[model samples]
Target: MTAVTDQDHTDQAGDAGSENREGPVEEPVGGDADRGGKDGHTRVESAKGGPARAEAGPGRARAEAGPARGETVENAEGQADADSAGGWDDGLIARRVTAETEQAAAVEVRGPNAPPAAPLAYDAPLHSRLDALRELVGLSRARLDSRTLAEAGQVLDEAAARRRLSGQHTVVAIAGATGSGKSQLFNALAGVAISETGVRRPTTAAPIACSWSDGSASLIERLGIPPRLRRRPLQSAESEAQLRGLVLVDLPDHDSAAVQHREHVDRILALVDAVIWVVDPEKYADAMLHERYLRPMAGHAEVMFVVLNQIDRLPGEAAEQVLDDLRRLLDEDGIALGEYGESGATVLALSALTGDGIGELREALGQFVAERGAPARRIAADVDAAAWRLRPVYATGRRTGLSEEARDDFAARLADAVGATAAGEAAERAWLRNANRACGTPWLRLWRWYQDRREPPTGRLPLRAHPEEEATARQRVEQAVRTLADRASAGLPAPWAQAVREAAVRGSQGLPEALDELTARAGLPPGRPPRPGWWPAAVLAQASMTLLQIVGGLWLVGQIVGVMAPNLGVPVLLMVAGIIGGPLVEWSCRMAARGPARRYGVEAERRLREAASGCGRARVLDPVAAELLRYREVREQYSRVVGV
Candidate 1:
């Protein structure tokens, strides 16, 4: 382990000189090393993106890759040792961060000379927040924009890697523009010349890590810092003891002319737990600093420390004026400022050159590190920022999925499309036609039958669209589907609304044909139209009248032939009575059949209407409702992620 002493200025300068002579020997892991990690662990790879051998310690050999899947390693005690090479499993940090008091009863074995481990603060709420985000993405990935869902997943993955590496250590980066004295402040905090400071523009090209305690290798490695660039502060001062879990980083100038340097700064800033933004009097209000970084990261005020470096350069009263102006600028950038123990950004003035106000800054940092909550707070702020960005996509005022009025209107439209009304009217007319045939005058019936032999009277009653209506039936059905979709998606967010419409369209693929088939099946009856109970009596009466007419005609014929004499014109009277009675009986039967025929037609209309309405509800309306329901469920999951 590399350690510095309070009385080792010469050795510190010598160490810095050796690092410069070796050129930039610290190579970042992987090509895009600053992308954080995947699966809750940092991606440790060689410079060429391949696995490389690593030195774990003086006597122990380490492999970049772990054991093969399902392979186990045993320690000297013949016990299973899963953390032999990687030191700990990926889930170890997660379990430690989220474990409750009840689980603390389990015992852990330690080496004879190993010191007792620090107690971990339980942050189950933060873990729960990450879980909520994961669930939300899983449920809404298809319904939402792919970019939004990807961003949410990135947040979860970043959180997992960070917490797994070191939940107790708070990684704080000192960042600023060129010639902003940030490197000077970093060295002063370390009490050694760890980061080189000079007048050259963008003196720091990459981040340097100075951890106050041991056991920070995993965290430093996760930050993409090479082993050679890692340093240790003097472990002799009581003031330094309070900062045991602090990992201070010196970042390159954010506004550097070199694109690669600026990229490095941005990537490192994204993964750090907190930031101590160092600004000077000359460039304290630079537009690049505020517009590019501070304004965009306003939600992270809880983990920000805005320090005005080089206060010694400003005149006595000018320093105060400049500090006040900086505060105003930060406020305009939407960063809340806190005084000492509040929940906002800490704004203060210090001079690394004169060591003025450095004591106050150290005290504040010590208190912050002692709390052991910076990791959780930074993760929470990240979640807040992501949730706010997605607010417009998932928010809505509508609680109900489908309205009753809209459903009824869709059913009515389907009934009309199936021609329910016209079918009922046709059935009523068919009943009348059949009744007329059964009870009309006998001579008229015979004439109709004779006429029917030449040209048959066609009487087939079935519910179906007219020849002209076939073309527009599908169009009417599609309109009903669109109407239901619109009703279900009202006031919904854009993504979910589109989803509902899509579901409606998908369910409507074969609906028109199905509805046509339904009506066809409902239209067929077993036999001819049902006959009323009084039909037989009417037939008998008609037969009797016909007999009388025949008798009268024969008597008249006999009288005219002089074979027998007629009595008091009885033959003529009988013929007249038979003709009038036959017509009267037909009229009475027609009137009686009207009421029953009308009822049957109405009943047929009701049944067909119900059948058409049911078909529509099953195909179109149900899918739309399901989409709405899925949106509601995902929205609630998003709310839980936001902790609302």
Candidate 2:
């Protein structure tokens, strides 16, 4: 039933003197003064926490807009409100100076765009979830494309930041369509014309804010309000004494024809702690208001309020009917009431012009201010909204890494390209070739030695000797990696799928060279057949045969010349037996070499396959698999964020 405005200095000073004779009296609310308010309600006394004033004494305390260093505002009970706030004053923008008294603290005009003071209260689980999200962002930023849920991520970041700045300042944005008496309601609450009101269409082009305390400079600045829009030459008024810790903002009309005005409303809606939707009898259930703002915000019902302003125009019975109709529309729009949705919105009826029903509105605000739970509830709702946006990425069941069958197929493809099978064959051939020389007839061994000394080392075997073949092998390795990535990301959301693709080839930029190098180092083992433990015995037997041949040849020559006994039949017989024994010993050694050759070939194939698989794992599959794990981990964290 009152409005604070320009007051003469003489009257204000005289009133201040009279008020000092009678100090502030704390009345007993509950029957027992000791309990304060036992009915679950607290009568919040307006505590002093603004810029420092002279120590409370018998007369009015001297006023200052911004206190000097180390000045603290202590209440009559010696309880502290803001002790460590001198740092915020340095960042404060131009605020209008004001006067004050000992009973009522001087309320100064804060810089419209000043930063916030003091962070939100301690929340353990909240901090844990925050830490988990930071980890997800850091680990997956480079690995995944982070576009689809960008808004959600941004909301989380800003929310955490705002809470860090100041939890005590509850930013309640009053929003409504044109001709909704929105600005009038704001002025009525603030007890001053802080927001412009008139017959002009789409007035209040920008948001206007009026706070009850002085420590929320940073929060005001963060809302993007400019300094020019704030009220000037502020004063301490008695009408605003009941509501402290409240920062009321009059936002631009949501249904304005001006696009910038609508944009402003939309932007501020995302940052506020609570929302008050102002409507009048004329457009109480306007479809534009309900569809554009209310229905879309169904999940934020807990922090919402529907004010049916200009009710004085309706007759008592008509007002009831209109109020009922408005309730139906709110139900349709899903906007709830009460500080925490204790019941259906008690659709408040008021007349900003007539000043009727204003007391009830003030009481509702007083309770909201006293409870101090709206900020927390509003923040919680914001998280819920953000979580809803990310449901598509996390709602489905978790996806694991590349399956076993796929990995094996991929490895097999790379092994073929690396010429592991070719190396195995070369090993077999080389073992057999050496065995031929080791066990061949002693006389023919001389011809084999001549051939071995002439061939180049590479031409000696058919083991991946072409550059064209090596290039093809590299391509095959890269392709296998791509296939695995595509299969793993199938059916996932686009961002996650894109992330998988990026991760799949993350380390593959150097894959071609890497594969070529790996293949080059996987050379076949030595071509010589390993000399068996019994090689000496076999060689000795062959040498003995050779000696017999030599001796026989000499004897035969002597007999033919008739120089010695011509009937020496034993010499011819010894030469024929030695020739037959040499072939028999050579055949046995070649047979024994077959088993060793097969074993050596198998070993060569294994070594090449191992080397090729190592390259595939490093350049392709590992990054993709890491991205999949990150997805699963973030999905788990999203569930925790929603408190599901």
Candidate 3:
């Protein structure tokens, strides 16, 4: 039989040693149960009470006695040992168990430590962190919505990119009256023969842009220049370097007799960021330019250059004084200049032909471009000016909501003024009475029975009776609307007032036609039929009744004569009663006709009210509705800007 190593013995003890005794055992090192000897090896005894077996190497040997039941031993190499010594060696077994405990303690202290197990499940802490970040993002989005900051963000982004791309470009537009020499200054500044400088007033029809090679082509494109008028790139080195990124514009004359040229100047002035207002000695103080353009552009304080051109014509000292006067005028017009302790405008003197201050002007322009970076703020000012001009068009106040009680009161007052309720009830009653009259005797008798069954009138009816010829209620309503419109427009300027008046006139133009249509639709009596003289109808009816009464009276007298001795006084009394009663009955019928006539008057008043309400809705309320729509659009744009 092959000898079992100490490692084999420990392995056999762990796996029940019967197979180990039958064959050579291949036990794992440091896997021992009974290696309690000093060399860290253990010995095991055979089951037949043989000597304790000494295992080779540094491991315990397996015993043939199958680990001696409960006896346990250990090796010094920090492994569990299983072994047996017969004859009740309890103390020895206890010592062996203590040795195994010490070995395990040593192994725990010295062995390679296992890394912490990889997180087998999702990390709750990491998920919580992500949730916190998501909440922060949501809050930021909500803040943006509340303030309309998103639009500001977009504008800032566009402006920043534009600034990054725009270099030393200084865009200067020449704006002036018809004979202001704006084109001459533009050509002088450009140092080239680019624009059409002429002697005729309002020479420049369209805006012309001249730029040095170093200037921005994209900016010129953004100005919406057509190909033919676009100037060729300047190639002179000194001109190119000094005027690098300089965009000089010769704009159309603003005070031209031709409306198209004036409009062109106005449009380009509104779009360009910087304006060099070119004024000559003659028309420098023109009130038309001051009122039409300069006053309206009061908000465009930035990037404004007021140039007194054609100074060559004036005496040298007089030119300085003229510039000072012009600056004072600009101040009075509310254009604040930085040189005068304000933040924005500038005034300069220049002679385009003499080129007296051209170098200084160019140097100042370059400095402006360098210091200000770009004209973004000026462009924003232009936009604001345009928006300001449009504000009056949308300055309507909201319609106040009336209380329910007020509405009811207004309706009642209007109804009473136009007699609507009385008219409606009267129309129904009149139709009923007319039907009764048109019916023959049986229906008339029925109507009388119905009326007799009801209660009698306590006094006059609740509403006053309408007159035979009703008042002009439709005309009154139209006049009221007109008066209200006039009051609403009383404080407006002439142009605005005129616009309101035109709108009102247009709105009411169709009123007469509408009233005619309403009258036709209502089926009211178009006009009154001519009545015969009252005496004629009265005489006819009375004569017929009298004839009947006389015939009856004569018959009755004859009957009485046959029956008994007839008295002559009875015949006379019967004839007199017949004649008098006939006229009385005729008078009673005529009195009864008054009620039907009053009902017709009521219906005429109702027709008038209906026409008034229709006109009010179409002319007054409809125009107000359209104006409100325009106001809403302006409000939306304003809100977008102010972050409301």
Candidate 4:
């Protein structure tokens, strides 16, 4: 923010820049500084501090200041210079006019070196962002692989810690390969001697933190920066006030020979809210940088900055060419460019040693600090990255459960294997046995009783299913479950499909025994239907017929003996009636048993089948159903995690 007084012109940018720096920040970092050859062109990749050294290029040091490369930066610098002139005094005409001429302000936001600053962040709040990250981690644990789960958990913890300790503070880390002058860039950005900058092979063994406010102590501690290396905000001048609440971290070199140094860089890279990757012109196109870090962090483009440090070495056109090439590499890395770009990776050119682009970098950082959305954006990016990592877990879409027809077929197969039909037949036969005892003709029933005495049927069901059937029943049940699992997990990922299969078999272990037990306890249909009124009549007629026969026999005997009056005609008629009625009544009772017995057989079979079905459902279908339910739950969880 620039202070404005009665003077029509305001020098807000100058005021901020002046407080931070009296002149450009300068320091020497270890490495060959030759950046180009005769044509002022150098290969995209220049080996730095290595055995192979390239010859020096013409005017390499100041070549980048040529017209072509300085087109944009020079214009900015020129405007700032013009703005720094004594004062703006325009002739005033005191007259009423419909329109007034006004000149637009050419705000020199950054110095000649850094790129233009971007707009403030437009993301959710820090807590919400961290909360979202935690939610993603929880979901991943249930539905994703171990690697994804661990990554999400780590990100969640780090993000929460950073947010808890630093309220509305932006943590911008300076990361680069060895000899990239990353430390120098860090110090330049702070406009103070905060980080150790030297020509040593590995100058920074540990991360150095420079804060612009006292609020960052806890934040720096959370970031794992030792208190010894921690520097308080520079309050000696008012310029640094613009950078208050900013925590600038100088990380160990990513390409350091020491494994510990590289590990430190990796650890710090993950925790920082934002990162400014310092790339020297020599190693600008290093594959290790792009492949290992930039490509993987494509989702975090918004909070990333790719700075081409030491641009002072390239000719004007050569510098432009290098920047263009760097942009190409970053694009290949899938990193985006600006807030307005589809991605969020900001690209710029600067020389930390010369401080040519330090003002621009500072301006950009100032805007970033002012935005106060770095934490939110960073956490959001992490969540997105986590989601992408677990993409394969849910690549396949959700499929509904097995069809009703398929299930019925499976059930029918199970019933057959369980001997449901056999049980029903036995029940029907049992019903018939009872029916006959209740309604059969008395004489014939006595005959049946005598026959049963010769060979009585066992009390146990005559139609009982054989125990040998248990094997076939178990096999059929297992097959049915397997089929159901296959269909349910058709398009699912391998792990989830395997889960469904395991779930299907969970209830199948003791199934055969259970079915056997069920069959053993299966109830047969009860017998003894209510007797009809005609049964009693029939019995009485049969008894009376017998008495009539006896009378005929006695009459005939008396006639022959001449002891009483002879009655041949009446006796004959009675005898004929008794014989015919007896036979007819017996026949009628036998015929009545036919229809009732048939019906009883059908009803008994139905009951037996029902019992068999119950066993099949509990032992077979129940387990399969459980698996399907689990599948549905997991599918829903993945859907939530991926937002699909």
Candidate No. with top TM-score:
1
Off-target runs (Cα >4 Å) in candidate 2 are 1-119, 134-161, 164-169, 181-244, 258-264, 280-287, 308-367, 386-400, 403-408, 443-462, 466-471, 484-510, 525-529, 537-584, 616-644
- In model 1, what is the error at residue 372, expressed in angstroms? 1.8
- Choose 2 or 4, whichever is better by lDDT: 2
The candidate with the higher TM-score, 1 or 4, is 1
Report the CA-based lDDT of candidate 4 relative to the real structure: 0.60
Q: Which ten residues in a row have the lowest lDDT in candidate 1?
A: 102-111
- In candidate 4, what are the lDDT values of residues 1-644, reduced to their tens digit? 11111111123223222221322211111111223322221111112211122233332111111111101110000112223312322111111111122111111111233322232233344445455546545544654567657876776666656555555578889999988988778756654444556666777777877666434555666666644355433233444567866888888889889998888888888888899999998998888998898899888888998899898988867878998999888878778778454557778888887788888888878887888878777877887787677656645655556678767776676667666676556555555565455445456678888887897462345432455555567777678667766776677777666766776677567766776666556644243443455667656767787778778888888888998698899888887877776677666755875576567556655665666667657765676666566556655654554444
Count residue pairs with overlapping backbones in model 1.
Answer: 0
Better of 1 and 2 by TM-score: 1
Cα lDDT tens digits, model 1, 1-644, are 11111112122223223212222122211112111123111112222212333222242222233222212111110122332333333221111111111110000111123232343343777778788888888988778768877768878888877756766678899999999999889867866445767676767776778777544556777778864455555334563577778989898889999897788788888888899999999999899899999999998998999999999988879999999999999999999888655689999999998889888899889988888788788889888888888888888866657878899899888888888888787777778767877888888788877876896343435444376687687788889999888889888988889999999999899988899888877763655688899999998888888877888888888898887786638988888878888988889989998998898788778877888988887888888888888888888888888997
How many clashes does the backbone of model 4 have? 10
List CA RMSD, all candidates. Answer: 13.5, 11.2, 33.7, 16.6
Q: 396 in model 1: Cα distance from truth in Å?
A: 3.4
The segments of candidate 3 whose C-alpha lies over 4 angstroms from its true place after superposition are: 1-170, 175-188, 191-208, 213-244, 251-271, 280-301, 309-316, 332-334, 351-356, 370-393, 396-408, 414-644
Please name the candidate that would achieve the greatest lDDT relative to the true structure. 1
| Model 2: pairs clashing at backbone N, Cα or C within 3 Å | 113-221, 114-217, 114-218, 114-221, 115-217, 115-218, 115-219, 116-218, 116-219
Please report, in order, the local distance difference test score of every candidate based on alpha carbons. Answer: 0.71, 0.64, 0.51, 0.60
